[model samples]
Target: MGRIPGRLPFFLETFAQSSIKSHGSRIHPERFNSTSNKVPDMKAHQTREVIFSGIQPTGVPHIGNYVGALQNWIRLQELKKEGKKEMDLYYSIVGLHAITLPRDPLQLKKERFEMMCVLLAIGLDPAHCCLFNQDQVPAHSEMAWILNCIAPVGRLNRMTTWKSQIASSKNSNSLSEVDDSMLHLGLLAYPVLQSADILLYKSTQVPVGEDQIQHLELTKVLAKALNKQTKNKNLFPLPQGIYTRQSKILNLRNPTMKMSKSNPSDLTKILITDTPEEIRKKIKSAVTDSIESIRYDPENRPGISNLIDIYQSISGQELEQVQRRFQDKSVVDLKSELIELLIEHFRPFNAEFSRLVNSREDVEKIYLAGSQKAAAVANLTLSQVKKHIGLD
Candidate 1:
């Protein structure tokens, strides 16, 4: 189908009419036409780019987390302000995904709330974006089950994430490794759920990190397969990956490993809730060579490059610009500048975090309301899928 002009007005009109009819109210033709004409220029801004992205609710995010993912989300929110496009942005706290590994139930629940606060702290306005827990919307799991039935077991086996986790676990002395049967169906079918999370919302664009490109491809494959299997024409649009330019932030101590919440060393990852003193100390002790000159070579000088990338990402400065700025500076000077930059950037976030954490009741209320709003759309799509598959 060709693109519709003034699509927002058309949609709003359809919704208003449906709502009025459902309520047994008389139709007002003039009101409908008046609203439609008011948005004639909306055609220029109409692009069906509904973006969806999620983060596992493991704990508070770090500097790398903000630069790599949340920063892009903030930029997209700003586009809405600029009237760039009519975006229906959904950012999920995927608590379901966090359970594939061992977790403390109480800590997991607390971390989920903390993550929501962090998202708001990072600048995702609830007015422009939908923020909620994953499991709260039943359609995610419901659609996942439908897709799971159609997904090939062979494809699931070929997924590298599960295989790598299994290999790592086997080498360790964990109890989960000893009992092969303990590998639950959910763990094996993680990608299927992930695909459902994206396609269920009819997301047209997904901002993905480098490691998750494969999962996005799997989502596209499952979407195409589902459409074909049900003999439906263009039921689920194939989502495109919106790549972020920020490089993955590696650990402060172990330069090779990505900065992860699961890291045992507290100093290796800088949590968003970390104090200014903590951030300063962490960057000061960040692994750097004994060499004198500062450079941006990732292969030979990973530690220095990692810091440079973080600075560039947050400051919106180019690598060349950073290099020029630090031409004659030593590694210590570079570290000092980075520490001050981080301290100033995160000061507001820490204050907001305290506010959100204090008002747990308000946060819970927002989650419930957002989940209901999200579920209404997701359930509509799932119902259509069921009817198409002869399961209605």
Candidate 2:
């Protein structure tokens, strides 16, 4: 298919309209179950499951981002297309979350648009997923504020991410040694905001990394608390975690650390849009052990093991199979194959990404339309929340 125009195309609009019609009716589950409960008699309980997830717009996504999250999202979309599952998927570029740390506004604005383009290039159809920016929908912040009021301070204090951030900032090994004054409210209350993001659309499932499980657990707590406080059995469904097969992709430079944009070295991670030469250069320089033979022993040979893991993950082969396949191969040989594999894997996506980049207007239209679609669902949930909390 040719690239879409600057405006949302007619077919996509028609698809959205049809989707709304099909899911127009809303049903609320009755009978609260504090411990465990029976099935609700309401037909609404059979509504298509909602899947929500958000990613920070730091910069272009890296290979780690692809393997750990983006690929899994594509899989989910494929499953939905094949009738293997029925779902309402919402993926957001979390511009708000990006600001919790220091950032250049102009750079951030650029990154957000590029992030949208990247998502589309990766095969996320506007008709299949509501892809938008969090800042575009004001309800995200509004809902976050409402949830913040009920979130326990003690719970936020115990959050390991907050403590770790503080510890890192102070260069301290002890959590207690880090001063509480160094922490910001946004950083501390991020879990509540994350809950708001998920519950705002009544998301039933969330795809998250293993590190974010604590925040998702807090989301469940807030959902249960809201249900109890409002005397509503099913005002919100506790969002469940849909963990990806590869939850963390380690940095190529340092196998012990998770790949991150914050890492100073560009060679440590592979960007989705990285040119063939860049991919070859980075993979060639990737850290590996002195041992000549290829093996997957993470405990002892983390660097080589990380490379093996990346190969298996991208190739969709079992770890044991990959290990056996490369047991006799030299480290240099393995690196060469990995470089070629990545280049081939990203060839089509890079072309699509280039098209989207040149057509920024079309990307914006897609994002705007996605925000509208997301708001329709979010407003419904927010309206019910307001009524229950006497805000209406």
TM-score for each candidate, following the candidate numbering: 0.84, 0.86
Residue pairs clashing in model 2 are none
Candidate 2 lDDT over 221-299, as tens digits, reads 9999999989996888887777545525778988877676666689989998899999999999999878999878887
Candidate 2 residues lying further than 4 Å off, grouped into runs, are: 1-46, 164-179
Question: Please, what are the lDDT tens digits per residue for candidate 1 over residues 250-272?
Answer: 88887766777666678888887
- Candidate 2: count the clashes: 0
Give the residue spans of candidate 1 off by over 4 A: 1-47, 163-183
Give the clash count for model 1: 0
Instruction: Give the best candidate by TM-score.
Output: 2
Q: For model 1, where is the 10-residue window of minimal lDDT?
A: 15-24
